[model samples]
Target chain A: MTSVLKLMGMKSMNSKAAKTPLIPYLFWILLFVIAPIALILYYSLLDLNGNFTLANYAKFFTPIYLKMTFSSFWYAFLITLFTLIFAYPTAYLLTKTKHKKLWLMLIIIPSWINLLLKTYAFIGIFGLYGPINALIEVFGFNPKQILFTDFSFVFVAVYIFIPFMIIPIFNSLDKMNPSLVFAARDLGASAWTTFRRVVFPLTIDGVKAGIQVTFIPALSLFMITRLIAGNQVITLGTAIEQQFLVSQNWGMGSTIAVFLIVFMALTMLVTKQNSKGGRA
Target chain B: MRDLLQATVAIVIVCGLLFVAAGQMQSKGSTGSKDTLTVFNWGEFIDTDLIKKFEQETGINVIYETFDSNEAMLTKVQQGGSAYDIAVPSEYTVESMREDNLLIPLDHTLIPNLKNINDDFLNLPFDPNNEFSIPYFWGTVGIVYNPNLIEDHLTFETWDDLWDESLKRKVFLVDGSREVIGMGLNTIGESLNVKDDKVLRQATDKLMTLSPNVKAIIGDEITPLMINNEAAVALTWAGQAADMMAENEELNYAVPEEGSNLFFDNMVIPKTSKNIEGAHKFINFMLDQENAAQNADYVGYSTPNEAAWDIMDPEVIADERFYPSHELREKLEVYENLGLTWLGKYNEYFLEFKMNLN
Candidate 1:
């Protein structure tokens, strides 16, 4: 692609006098990314008539919406916490297992399916007449309603997002120098101590990266919450979709989007500082 | 230097091909022709064969596009560049579109087959006088219940049964603002279009009463549950209920005595349409009895074409889920576009209700 572009009178980057290759990317970012965000910010600050106003944000900060914001954060935090507990050990075992590549591939295979499809598959399995309920019934228990409940909501969220958490942790774990554990062991550290002090510290970067990816998306989760939790779960993403689609409140939708961007930025900053502290 | 010229020519050719491909994709009708009619509608709502047949018969190439929602369709048409010759929007959306003057007054002279529409479906408050739109497919918002499961709990007669505490966790409400809240309004004997704040509050409270019993607020996902007998009762559209009832013997549908939402999707020519004649041709073609019946059967939605009744199967005509009896028909109210302010209020209450669930 670069060769094709270069041949079409685009300046080659090899020459010292050549313009920075970042120019095209900068233009793209300006047009698609920055401009849309700028437009959203502009919309956020306006009423429906295109007049300047901050009432959109004020409307968003009402007690109900505030509750929605806190609930979104809480759900995201829980998803992040659950994914960390479930994925860290699984990723660690993945590194130890024979055919690690195959096992890693197997772990990632489900994510290759569409997110909607994955949620639907879980819905079928979690429904009252589903296989799990069928098995429970065979053993004499009444079939349970797993779906449209908090448990299934979090379960499906974790299922869809575990790969995102695992991949980053796996990358950091794989990159860890195995000799650090040996060094800690030779210094009379027990297996648990070695893991806690050396191995855990080493994987902190991956864990931070993992949390950054998983937690951010979880904050804005819409489809899974609706499908698995049956509109019983309302995250910020659902609110944004409703505003734009159902309510036709472009101003309010843009206002919520702007807040989400701030939330994501604050989260990234917190993780970035924590990782720096961990390394220190 | 020679290779550079050759490479530049290759790049130009590739760019030209991409430009051409994009142009073709955007234009529903073949390039720059008066013989093309562009149509926008819901995805899979129309059978492709019908479009092909229309194209073949008129030699007017059809450019077909689809939208998932009426809001998205309005947004596209409002943006003013796509130039769709026709769009099919739901009942409430047609009102908004007409009010905004986004649609053109149809020349009934061009579409004489407008007579095919059932008198009951005509002169709807949304497009009264049949000026801007023609009825496409119509259905009612009603209850689809499993007789086997609810035999002992409660009799399903009035909208009040949906709120029965004895059937807690066995009911599924359709995931829409208008349908769910409209049921509440109906149960309280208020008009479905009640915009009074006091009435709206009462309706919200009534909805809250049923909140504990709702297993899920769902859309198309209710179909599988209804068919599989996982849900005892689901408030769903007539089309969906009819389809599910066909598969599940024990399942029955009811248009409660209090009243329910009877909605229709209408075909309209947008103000920006470039092929008015072709648009009329397409609408007229679709209204033909045989064609209307074929499209209805294919799409599994009820048709408003009275002529279609002649060609349709007796079983479909007898299916009360799709065709309500005269008494039930009197109790059914067509959904009105509650305008923007009321729409926002409804959305707020609906969101609050959903949030209160957990």
Candidate 2:
């Protein structure tokens, strides 16, 4: 990434001092990115009162934390799956449209409004007296409570994650040459076969990118769980927030965060291999 | 699926904003002129008009910030990203701040109106002889229920009644580890400061039994839930219960006959403050007989200012249940500052209880 950035900088600047532009990015990496992670690691080894201790790490390995980790991963997997299932088709369809960029822009407009407002909107939309329940009651059935449930939790998460999933898939689909599909058809391949063997294989990178973006945040989602799920879900993010802010156990929060970091790295590693394997 | 693209754009925007906020915080450590006083208190705990009035009268610029909880407030002050002159924290937080040397002793000369405060609220266990803190407001943790929603056969008065079947999936707990776990302890007759896991486990197990009745555990949103009748019963503070009752006249608050928490919010000067003189002025301004009474009327919690009672809302003053008489207060518990270890344990159990909500 640095080499690519340097090459781009050298081309843009048309000078030997291309290295100057790299300084700010290097500083940002060192200060904002690297420093915070280093702090988390350092803090993880200390107890509540700043005394050195490894109890936090041991606590993370306990059954309770282990169970929470498992549940968090399960929810993240479900959210990623649903987001991809929904976003992939929409992105593919968008690429086929005449005003694809305008349509994409229009779709992206709602996300500009505050996320909290959007989340609260879902509260009313799924409320007992809300439109969904009203629709149900229209069918002559009683309105059911829909605000605080696992379904609402996943639904809201997928809603929030959809755009992240769609953009990458859309980009990849747009990049593909339309002649590939025609070539596959010329070989007597069915439409489904063309997509499966040619189009889908090419777009695997975008899908993997979508999964990468969706799953990591889904694992750490704390606020959505509290507001929509009514605290029924305990993501690792929620636990970390509880430990840090409520319990004042920075050590424990940082230890959990370190684990989250590891999990994120593992996820990145898993998603990254597909692109490499496809390229070769 | 189009929503997916919109959300991605939103995420990018939010990340950019977060970076900007971080940058601002780094450059925000310096306090403004002495005329500026930064006051940090709980969300919606103070009257805004009074803030404007104070600013006008004192010729001091009031920079007001609100925190959702005591822990969050303490963390902000401790982190020192911004300077806060005065903070309104609950009893135990004031106590902990004192222990941590995070507070400066109050100057009584600057706050002569402290003489108007009730004797009972003056010097509590948290701060000896009223040195480090001054009572801002005091209230109880109680069950606020709507009688119209309760089944004809169902009755509730004490903390145990929260477990009643008729209230199933209707109870909303205040989102506090100490408050929720303390209510569980109150049922089993354990102190709020349970030092050991054995009693805590008992409280946790009992709370699990009450899980069927718990609809949600929340913060500021709990009030709306109660007002909308979405939650038929809520475990909330006296002031918030009062707010809910005002909005929905049918709601009734009951401090369970079993011992309940008597939370006292106090004004403390954290070490992060650069404007101690301005802070003292603000505190005194808040404590003035007329100002205190007006605040009491607006904020709706039981006032610590004895002088405020004479001119405050007659009905509120008469409601002995909300503002407990001296004898009733004898049974009310003030939350003790359980050091980090025990506090962490309480939080752990409460997290478990929350995770078991569904």
Q: Name the top DockQ candidate.
A: 1
lDDT of prediction 2: 0.87
Would you give the TM-score of chain B in model 2?
Answer: 0.91
Give a tens-digit lDDT track for model 2, residues B1-358.
4555565566678789999988776555453447788899988889899999999988989899999888999999888777888999999999889988999999898999999998999878899998989999999998888989887544455777888887878888888998899998999998877798999999999999999888877788888878878778888999999999989998988888788999899998899887788899999999988999999888888898999888887888889768888999988899999988889999989988877776
lDDT of 1 by residue, B62-140 (tens): 8889886777788889898777999999988999998999999999999989899988888978888989999999888
Residue-level lDDT for A233 in candidate 2: 80
Task: Compute the TM-score of each model's chain A versus the native chain A and list the values.
Answer: 0.90, 0.90
Error of 2 at B77 (Å): 1.9
Best of the candidates, TM-score:
2
True contacts kept of each: 0.56, 0.64
Clashes of 1: 1
Task: Write candidate 1's Cα lDDT for A149-211 as tens digits.
Answer: 978988888877899999989988998888988999999999999988888887888898999
Clashes of each: 1, 3
Give the lDDT of residue B151 in candidate 1: 54
lDDT of model 1, residue A228 = 87
- Model 1 compared with the native: what TM-score? 0.90
